[model samples]
Target: MLKPILIQINPLDNVAIVVNDHGLEKQTVIEEYQLTLVDDVPQGHKVLLKALKKDEAIIRYGEIIGYANADLEAGRWVNESVTRMPEAPELDKLELATRPAQPLESLTGFTFKGYKNKDGSVGTKNILGITTSVNCVEGIVDYVVKIIERELLSKYPNVDGVVGLNHLYGCGVAIDAPAAIVPIRTIHNLALNPNFGGEIMVVSLGCEKMQPERLLNMTAENKRIALADEDIIQLQDERHHGFESMVAHILTVAEQHLEKLNQRQRETVDASHLVVGMQCGGSDAFSGVTSNPAVGFATDLIVRCGGTVMFSEVTEVRDGIHLLTPRAANEDVAKDLIREMQWYDDYLTAGKVDRSANTTPGNKKGGLNNIVEKAMGSIAKSGTSSIVEVLSPGQRPSKKGLIFAATPSSDFICGTQQMASGITVQVFTTGRGTPYGLAAVPVIKMASRNNIANRWYDLIDISAGDIAVGKKTIEDVGWELFEMILRVASGEQQTWSDRWGIHNSLAVFNPAPVT
Candidate 1:
């Protein structure tokens, strides 16, 4: 028989979450706390440790997560229905850089074998990315990509794979609108990712609003591609060409890029060349207790090794902005963090909804009462590193170390924006389980509960859940994850997502009006 376990995160906490996989039944006795369960608390759900009157504050993680709806007795289940979410922290009243992070010891001698680009960026994979100017060419691009995989991929064993960077933009209703820059720059930067090996090839329909030249010249901060006339293949050109001729031309141009990519070789580089993104979805209560904290530990290690790490999802960070501002490297970076939060707040207001909409049914069922509680847990992946910089959606980092990339909380959009910002690998934590992956980079999945890890044995990469069962310490899992990151980045190991080929389609965040 299994013993019932309850985990209290802080000395001030009035509630503790049920840790046993099957939960504890009513009348169950816990000798540690000298209390009996008044209700059947489900796994990951919280149980009150002290009786409270109506509207009393409910505390967890040493913070007020919510307020009781009515008088609540001790040992009772406290779920979303019984808890009223507190208001978000006031952004204007926040103190900037009040408690900056203490310096961490240096982590040196970590390296990975990666392909080096002439622009000074290192890539974990060498791929030929085929971009498109408009959605009209999407079908053709997809078609030709299949043929290339079948015919040409085998010829170049050095190239990892080919990706057709197709999206639902170009020739749309409001291409010149002020907000249009979001998707446009996103598509522009996507083609220049390190994995593409700087072999920029675009299949244009020739009549799209977003011209090939304009897209290529979107930015100069990153080394812009010197547009070659032959690199842009116009399917609508007045040549003696049918569908087969177009396919033949595309295949020829792709082969040229492949030949260049195949010539590149992997060389050992320090971990400073690595850019990692951390995110979570389908989260549960143990997220903060196990997986996220473990990820945070690894995040700190990456920063210590002089690598770049970014954690995003704007709404998820909104409530925790107060906690993060003090850790900023300086006042300017602190303001930059606040600016992104204010922008997202206005964006949400324009849509007539608030951050409360962020929590899903799965999240509530997993013991997250509301967005406030979820946000507190979500920011745990940032670790204790100082905030070195802040970035807008799709904007690449100017400096290294820990960065805050402002992006939506949706898993797909967040992943896409992170990739555009130039992340070569991602770590995703989940408790409810997700098969999410991206074709452009490798995704490592971490599970928060022993049950999920055991049930989905082959799907999960690292079992942070063992911390919850007292089988492993957070430091043990942290070092394990940090080592695994180097191996995966070096191509010495394959994540389950890549091994199973479970790549989700790219989802661009288009806040502008869609025509």
Candidate 2:
């Protein structure tokens, strides 16, 4: 028989979540708490510990997640329909640097095999990236990509793969607006990603607002890339006569980059060279108790080893900004964190919505009550490290430690932005389940429940589910993740997503106008 279990995160929490694989029925008793279920609660759903009058605060994680909408009885199910979300924390009144984080013990003597670049960046994969200046070239680029994978990739065994940086923001848009900087810089930085090995190439239509010169100039101005005119292939140039000519030109240029990439080999590098990005999607209530916390533990391990770690998703962190501001390393970083939060606040306001729109139906079905409840779980991926730096979308970090990269909550846009910021590997957590991956980097997928892990045996890379049932401690799974990251970074092991060839397309975050 399955053991009846209830997990209360904090002593002050007034509700507890069911932990059994199959939820307990009415009249079922949890001997530890000596409470009976008044209603049939599904697995991962919360149950009230005590009856409450209308408008009473509901607490979890020792923080007020919501208020009861009606007079709730003891042992009844508590979910989105019965909870009213609280207001977001005020940015201007937030405390800064109140409780700075102490330094963790140093972790040394750890290293991985990585490809080093002249710009001092290290890459976990060796790839040849063909950048596009306009969406007009996508079809051609897609056609050429298949040809490269089919005919060219086998010849260069050292080159991991070839990818075309495709997006929809090159034409029919306001190119000179201030907000345009976001998408423009994103494209420029995508080409400079460490995995591309300093070999920059671009495909441009003969006529477009975002010309190759303008696009590549951004990188040159930032001192990121230096390329000659030969590096760009202009389809409408007089040299190209027909469709065959363009395909031949692209293939020839691709071979040149591939040959250069093939010459590079992995060398021993310090673990500090690793730059990891952490994110979560399709979350359920178990997210906070299991997978996310385990990832947090690993985040601390990475920071201790002198590596760089980033956690992003602006709306997901907005509600919990107060808890984070105090952990900032200094006043400047704290202010920067607030600046990003404020920017997102205004952006959401302009769209006539608020952070409450962040919660998906899947999230509610998986047991989350509102955005307030979801934000608390989402921020756990950052671990407890002090915020050493804050980065705008697509901006790389100068200091090494935990960083908050301001980005939208969409999974594809977040992954793209993190890649633009120079992440060579990513750790993703999910409870409701998603098959998300990025082609430029290897993503390590983790499941928050045993049932999902058991069902998606081949898809999930790690299972933090055991932490919920007392089979393992957070430290145990955390240490396991740390070791796995090293192996994956060294190219000694392949994540399931990489092995199965599952990858999502790049989705750039464009808050700018499209006129």
Candidate 3:
């Protein structure tokens, strides 16, 4: 039986959340109080348990989440309300306490099959990527990929695949502006990504916000590769000829790297070398019950092994950060985490976008009711590890541990930024299921429903639905998943994303201009 608790979030709050629903019937008496059923609150939804005057605060997880726009009463259902008042308390002033660190237990010397680069970074997979500077060159880059698929690659089994990254914004944006900088940095990150075997053939229009010369200059100082005679010759030729000829010549040169890449194999490396990114999309009630928690267990395993795991979708962590704050590495990291929360609050308010509107229409139909409840379940993927770092979108992790990346909750956009930040692989949990994938990294789909997994076995690599049906514990499923990660990293299997040919359909965060 589930126990529900009425959580009084703050002293100023007018309402409390039903945290535990102890399976008690309506009008049941407990702790000197007779509890009545409020509106039928779903797992990730809220119910108002008290009456409040207009402008009274609404609280959850012991923090102010929002305010009431109108008078509210007990037993009322709290849907997505547009009221955005009530800022979070300052982290420095908050009287929160930290938990003592547990004894460190690490996964022993487990290494994925990867390409060891000269710069000391190991790639989980090897790929030949045709990077574009702007949309104007998208056609040329795509054409080059067609040529690779048609003419080359059949002879090179080591080459994972060839991809072209095309974006809508790049030529018309202001140079060095957020819009331009985001894409430029993304491209730079992709080129430097270890998954590429330090081999990239960039295609550009010669004139764009990101110049081919500038892109080349950025990687000139990279220590990953020794200046080989063949690489030098190809670079000189590409610089002399225009874009079209350069694209052709680079395709020929790529064949050479592909031959060498095939001979590489997985070797024993430290588990600490692994960095895993956690994400979920198209969620349903079973998400938290099965796939999410199972992934959370895997996250715990990775962190326990001295590896780093990252969880993004900040908006979805609203109700869940409370459970995570106590694990913060230090006061400064905790403050940054809270500051990011506040920043999202202000950003939503300024744009007049209802924060509760965070849940997509599909999400509600799938059983979620509000952001707070949805957030609670979403954070289940982080496991019980302490958060060592809090990162902005596309920021790389400086330390090895569990991290929370502040990113928009959008699936494609967030997934793209995670890949750009050097995550070699993504563990994407889905109940409703999604087909999105990144250009530079592999995405492994974990399905939470047996029916969905059976129907779409081609798209799903792991079926965690067994958890929902009580056939497996999260720990059992997590070990299975950990083994899968190890195998995928060792190049023993192809991820669903790799098979479907889905790549380069997402980009980094760029704020929309205020009209």
Candidate 4:
């Protein structure tokens, strides 16, 4: 028999998560009987409450997670439990019930000095981005950015910076394929993003799968085409003269746009205009208990204020989908969640890979025993909001409510996609920690533990460990986080990632090729 250790989550939950590191090492006293140990278990893991038949449902958080693969004994550890059953929360005592529509209040009239675009979108920075359609032209884009940094930017006070958003996959994939569509949409979205001025300098090799014209069409209203007749004519003239002449010509043109971009400033906008992306990296056990819930509360506050909150990484949503599905705007949205889950399953199966292989070695060391537990913790960052829409990777939410974007669980990839989808700000929760930033968006790092925050104060924007110490409530931390978000959006604050120059990157969803 296993020794019973009291672990409580909620009053209604039937089973307590096993905190014992070696629950299956030997027979120990548990709740009911002197049961013999069945299998080895890890800490921050779960074990069965009773015997479960093959294909029987496994329940946690009082909801079905997945079904059993084989018969489970009372003392057996449930390894990667998979339950198909769906359980709904009791309406009377719901923690986050769908309440009646309340009149929303805007954030106290405060605004950041930012660029106002022709399309009514606001930009936190005025940047001149040189985007390429394929890796073949990445060098050229980089060269252009370097030239801008060296010559043009020195004269322009208004321009934030110049950058080349490069990626590996743009060709050798089917046109409009899932892989191709993501990058194409991402480039288009980047061009339309409010942070950049009306002018964009597009560089293409002319034969990539993601054509530059596709990007141009998306931002038809305000766009500047390069590598065309006039630009080619200019390039030819500069080459004939000398390299210095070419550099000078580029700088002169860039200065014009920089002057125009700098003229814009931030103005007060309603909170409804804000869209925030929730992300986590280097997560630990404390992630779910502290920073994640704190961010979740902020998520709820944003949604209540008629703003949008986006949670991507479909893989991380596996265990929490049940908890989230009930809050979907309708059955279709819930079905979309199911469809995405199935797609990931099929993707792994078709590739002849174990789906559970997605869990990182670091996760296991940090007290995350399996994907279910990690996912449960990851989804807590969304709080309790109705999923108003489901978006493919790189696609923006059409309606204003909580959204789920289908993306890979890798932090850089997920963060990149979130920014590409037009989220101007990101709240990255970490327990272990990573220094990551996006090209165009600002990331605010929130540490889950006090020790981590103290040790890496340079990289952490907020320490949410106060919740664990009972010094602050989740609501209090959330309001503080919301204020930080505003400050970041308004250009008043800088993230640790930004200070350290950690602009790690990944493109929108591009699936691995099936051999």
Candidate 5:
């Protein structure tokens, strides 16, 4: 017998989640609650603790997750179909920072081996990134990247890789739209990300609205580079007579960057330079019970070391906005968070959708009934640390500690923007499983259950599943995650996602209109 186990996220919660897959059956005995099952319940689904009348609110995590649409018996299943979404919190009335951040025991003197950048930032990997001003050049860029990796990369022992930044922006769009600032700043900041070693090499089609010079912002000295102005490579230049000439030009410039990258070696630095991004997808009920909580613990450790940790995906956390405000670092940070929420609300309204539209079939199948339940699980990645800063899409952080970067809940878009914000590493949690990674950064994937991990053991870098079965404490797996972050950040270990070369293309968060 599996003891008919279930988990209660909060003492005030009237519902509990079944932890065992296919473990609940008719006449099940919940010895812990002394309650007999009235109906068959599947694993990862909700089980009511007591009877509820029609139109009563459903509480989870001590918050109104939803309201019952029909009367339900005690110990009966309460899933999405029978629940109605609760009214969203009013942004204006949300409270400001009222609780001081929980202090952790002193975490003195932790370090990782990294390559220091000219701007005083650091990188876990040394790579040569090739930027493009338009998608018309992507085919050639990919060809060049393959050739470089197959041939030139082998020659330079120290250079980790050469990744081509291929994106679908820069053409057929109103470049002056108020929202255009998002994509422009994204491309600009990505070029300066510390992992690229400050070597800006851009390839352009020469006639697109986004000129190479504009993308590179060449007018002002990029004070961050501290290097001589470099020449841009334009494919349409008269000097480049044919395709071979263009390839040769790129190869020559790439070798120069590879040579420079190979010269840089890793040195031990304190954890303060780390900019880490945290996210979750394909999440199940156990996401809150296992992986997210463990990640949160690691988040606290990173924050204590004076490092930065970003937890993004606005829609995924929108339902929990009321809880987040009091954790903001100050009144200004709280207001900024509200402003982002309002902006996103307006954006959704413009598209005739609401936060409820965020849930996916997979989310429902994985035991997350709706966005409200999903948000409850998603925000746990922040731990109990104060949200020290708030960033709009494509904006880099000016301070450290936990940050809330407002981005779409889409995994690809969120990951791309987080990379643009200068995160050197990302820890992704999934209950249903996803192999998402970024060419510009390292991604660590953790599974919430052992069955999923065992099936995709080769893909998942870490497993926090044991927390659900009482085999491991959240602290045990959390400290493991903290150590893994350092090792991965130091380039001593390669994430499974990195090793497999599994990556999603850049999906820029462009709200600008197409011309």
Candidate 6:
């Protein structure tokens, strides 16, 4: 039995969030807040604790999320319609590196079993990745993949699985544009991900703008072999007489990569070898109150253990830009953070839209008032580590720590960028519910409420709902997630997403011109 509870995120906040889905009854006693409700508060929604004039700022997480659209009194429902977005902070005026995080003394001695690559990176899954230069040969790749799974994969017992890096950016677009680097580099990097065990194979459609050689690392021999020509199987090759020929050619090449991956074995590695990407989607008010904060705790634990963690989604963090700058590792990092923020701002402006447009109808119904409120919660997935590094979209990390990889708020696109940056595992927190996953990595889904957990028991991997129900503390759930990452990383456990093979397609962020 659970009672409708009010959650005050910050003492300075003028609003409190409803914790239970059914909401509280009018005049019901809330023992924690020491106040009775004047009206029924819906689950995950906010309740105003004080009167505000039009234009007065609405504070949550101890920062301004928005301004009042009209005068409102205490006990009123402060929904999205009544709050107007405030102007984003000027980039030049943000403070830099004010809250340098102290070294963690609590989490030490943490490690996970992973495969060590020749390039010095570590991988959680030993997989054979098949890369493609265009979408034209997708059906052929899918058909070949099914055959490989049914006929060839059984022989290579050590290889986890095979994934085809199918995406929409290879052809039918302006390939020579300055922004073309975004997709080209993205596909190139996706093949080089640690999980592939350094074996690269490509299937080219013969005449696509993105050639197989272009998607590989260039050698200085005047020849355009990226991964290696011998490893590439072009569909238009003169030797391929028919579709079956192409399929036969692909299977032969795949068997070779599988042999290499099958020989690699998991070994104990320092947590430093682990790079993780964290994101939130289908969010609700309890997302910040429960799952995100608990993820923050787990993030801190990972950082303290000498691991690298990436938190992203530019629009989700733009409203709380001021809070992030001061905690950046240095002035350069703070400025870099501002650059991504400004880029996203201009991007939206170019489209005649703004940050407020990011909040979906599902978001508003789930109790989030606006993007600002969402930002305050979304940024929580980063935990309290100093922003050690900042990266542009499609870039991989040169050093380890807490990195903020700039990416769009779209779940699939962000996950794709995270994979590009070398994250072998992902922890996705959801409130309204989403089945987002990536073929390049194992994603551990954390639900924000018990009701959602109970309803989608098989789909969700872990439940942060206990934090909201007060059955478990944030530390309890955080440690649980941390341990789960190791088990899934070590191949000892499989996430529901992995079991169901529910991977979403790669969505490379193309902010530049498409024509």
Identify the candidate with maximal lDDT: 2
User: Residue-wise lDDT of candidate 5 within 1-515, one digit each (tens)?
Assistant: 65788988899999998888675997897978877888788888888898899998888888888989999888888788889888788887888998747765657699999999877899988999998888899999999999998888888898889888778898898887888878877887777778998887888888999876567663332233233334478899898989999999888888888988999999999998889999998898889889999999999999999899999999988889999999998999999999899999999999999999999898887778889989988999999988989999978888888999888999999998998888999999999899898877999999998889999999999999999989999999999999999999999999988898998999888888988
Judged by lDDT against the true structure, how good is candidate 2?
A: 0.92
Please write out the lDDT profile of model 1 over residues 1-515, one tens digit for every residue.
68888999899999999998888999998888888889999999999999999899999888899999999999999998899989888988998998889888988999999989887888888989999989899999999999988988999999999898888888874888887878878888898789888899999998888888888787655446687898999999877278998988999999999999999998999999999999999999999899999999999999999999999999999988999999999999999999999999999999999999999999988999888888888999999999999998988888999999999999999999999999999999999999999888889999998888888888899889889889999889989998998998889999999899898888888888877
lDDT, candidate 4, 1-515, per-residue tens? 33454233444433344444333453544644345446555544455666888887665555455577787787675554433333322322322323322333444553445557776666776777655566776655567678777776867776778767677756776666545556667666666566675566555566666666765555432233343433221333324376555545555555666777767666767666677899988886567767888999888778877777899877778656657766777767776777777677677678797446666776655555556666777888878777888887777677886888887788878887787777878899987777778767788999887877988888889998787656898889998998898788777887777667678755656674412
lDDT of 6 at 74: 77
lDDT against the true structure, per candidate, is: 0.91, 0.92, 0.68, 0.68, 0.87, 0.86
Candidates sorted on TM-score, descending: 2, 1, 5, 6, 4, 3
Error of 5 at 226 (Å): 8.6
Please report, as a residue range, the 10-residue window in candidate 2 with the lowest summed lDDT: 219-228
Clashing pairs in model 2, backbone N/Cα/C closer than 3 A: none
How many clashes in each candidate? 0, 0, 11, 14, 0, 2
Model 4 global lDDT (CA atoms, 0 to 1): 0.68
User: What's the TM-score of every candidate structure?
Assistant: 0.98, 0.98, 0.78, 0.79, 0.97, 0.96
- Weakest lDDT window of 10 consecutive positions for candidate 5: 218-227
In model 3, where do residues sit more than 4 Å from their true spots?
1-97, 100-103, 178-180, 213-247, 259-263, 512-515
Candidate 5 residue pairs in clash (backbone atoms < 3 Å)? none
The better candidate by TM-score, 2 or 4, is 2
Residue 204 lDDT, candidate 3, scale 0-100: 57
Supply the global lDDT for candidate 1. 0.91
- Model 5 gets an lDDT of 0.87
The residue-level lDDT of candidate 6 at 238 comes to 98
Name the better of 1 and 6 by TM-score.
1
Candidate 1 residue 506 Cα shift, in angstroms, is: 0.5
- Candidate 5 Cα errors over 4 Å, as ranges: 218-230
